[model samples]
Target: MNCGCDEQRRVTVSRRRLLAAGAAGAFAGLAGSQLDTQLAFAADPAYSGDVLVLLSLRGGFDGLSAVVPAGDPAYYAARPTIAVPKAQLIGGGTFFGLHPALAPLLPYWTSGKLAAVHAVGQPAPNRSHFAAMEELERAAPGTSLRTGWLNRMAGSLGADDPFDAVAMGTARPARVLDGPAPYLGLTSIDAFTLTGDDAVKPVAATMAALYQGAPPALARTAGQLTGALARAKALRSAGYTPANGAAYPSTELGAALRDVARLIKTGAGLMTATVDSGDWDMHENLGPAQPGRRMHDQLAQLAAALAAFATDLGPDGLNRVTLVTISEFGRRVAQNGSGGLDHGYGNAMFVLGGGVRGGRVYGSWPGLTAAQLRDGDLAVTTDYRAVIGEILRARCRVGDLAPVFPGVTASSLGLVATR
Candidate 1:
């Protein structure tokens, strides 16, 4: 009756404010765009590695329900009401099986393109949504650095292009992509255009002329804005079509992933991209592994969109792409009274890419018995940062993981291969 996670979720920048910033080409927005303008002045090193896509599963994800531990009898004992029947599982060997809801991803699982790491979470768990997510993005604990880990990673890699660090699916960047590294946020590719600019009234040109003889700071800002507008126009003129017969679901996530694919194909100098999927905090009515239920429908939607994205990318596109999922924490090991789950720790992460060693779950499995649980939650056997560190080093070609993860060491889970 006395659960600890009762704080209100954090409110970020409003969508209207984000749009206004984009339209006004403010200093921060200009800095994000200046990456493009600054390219002409510096010999930009070409990034010939995998594009890392960070999919944030907002709301505490119930990894236990999704990645069932049929091998352990204690699992069913803990969540009798909401437990996914072992017989109804989709992909698994003898000990573990995935919930039937994720059927769409089974093909990728079978083809060795998808995998999961169980019992993974932060070094320390925080139940509050805002606090946990902030820690997750910041990644560094007990350190003075306040920049997001993704930003640090991008900065370390010498990325300066506006497209290098992208926060797609919304009008503003996610906290994970926050910091000094240049990045842009947009709901979609076409929605990135400047507002109130037409043939008769050229806002970009007008601003350029106004700031021609201005101070250095004002002039640089103007140049960055105009330059970004020109590049955006070129991209719009080129247009895009999803290759390999891939059809996005027209949902927020689908649209966002579509644009990410578009930018990658366009060679927009993208290094890291972030997307968000929420509503995983199912504290009630998380029905069985059947259609029309809460968790079932959510997972299906997620699987469908992800499968489509991978299909559209095809083998070639995926070969240069690495997609990973992360959440603040997992659900309680034992289901709460309302046939739902409460905030806990040690969630599961999915890794999908051409170089992934899939068709099997990775990580040391801490059993579901009460003794094995960590204060009523799944005990974390793997640090989430290490999992990402592995992907960064193997697929993204990040030279050093220390700057991005601080004191954390990269995992040798063989989740991805060094090409």
Candidate 2:
């Protein structure tokens, strides 16, 4: 009875401490404490490297269908009803083949601007979507670190600029960017404005006046909002159109990436940005590599958006941008009765950039034999963090990865050129 009481007290105290820390951080954000201090101090230098774009595939991504291992007999045997046929594949080598739906990316793949790593996943298998995504974003396994890896990376770089890191396509911030780094969440560029700001009565201006000569917290918060409104207004006035004859699909992913390109072109000091694409869950009716099938249409949409993004960026713009695709986890190797895969392990990651060594797949080909499977799931041969770490070190020019990945040695896949 005494021990139980003590445990309850400890839990209450921990919750209180957590609440206090959160409140303080919220207030500090209002005051721009970290960003304000950053601008005042010359402690950290500027990051001169690629603008990293993290694309989150929200549902379980089936790598076996996408980066098909045509050479693996077991893969075909396991997914007898759903394997991507060998003849329908595109740019992969003798051992691997790209799904026919990904043909839109053929040019970039052939030109050595896109690459992929297979048999890659988290440190451990997690079948639950919420738990897997949470762990994926938090990144620090076997540790007490609560900050997201992307936020940690931004903080490490001493990013004070509001545009340094952004979560596009949603007003809510991505869990990956949930630290002290000064970042913004926007549904779109033009949509980022004060609730009541207009030509006649500027709400931003009114708020500024109301907070005039107020305490640092209140005053700074008003100033930041006003400043953001001004920037948005300027961007809206400028008017943006896709460059290099790039045609963006009229889709959410397309628009989000279009905005990202706009920010990059406008020189907004964008270090990192995250966008999400869903509906890859495909637990039923994930048809063949045809135009009318569920998986086919989904992949087509993704391909079109990505191809448009690359086209808009053009060669010069893409030279400084690295886009990576990650999911919480991959689906099962074998198809179920409904002709779909369930949550499993050992997914695939795609890397696209000028520095990427394209036209081939990276990582050891973990065999799909029943004996080799991890409880009916593909065994992970490469840690996903290591893959990101490699990109961070090589393309992003991050000198020390210890702070971001914590004790993980980055893979030497030569997937991207060294800085």
Which RMSD values do the candidates have, in order? 6.5, 9.0
In terms of lDDT, model 2 sits at 0.76
Q: How do all models score by TM-score?
A: 0.88, 0.88
Give the per-residue Cα lDDT of candidate 2 at 407.
84
TM-score of 1: 0.88
Model 1, span 1-419: residue lDDT tens: 11212121111122343335543434322112101111111115478778888888889988888888888999999888888898899896788899998898999999999999999999987999999999999999999888889888888887765342333222335567677666655444454544456798776677678778887755665566566557667877999888888877856577667777777776666787777788899888888888999999888888888988898889998998899999899999888888889899999999999999999899999998888988999999999999999999988888899999999889998888897
The residue-level lDDT of candidate 1 at 338 comes to 89
What local lDDT score does residue 215 receive in model 2, on the 0 to 100 scale? 81
- In model 2, which residue pairs have backbone atoms overlapping below 3 Å? none
lDDT of 1 at 88: 96
Q: Which residue ranges in model 2 land beyond 4 Å of their true spot?
A: 1-46, 163-172
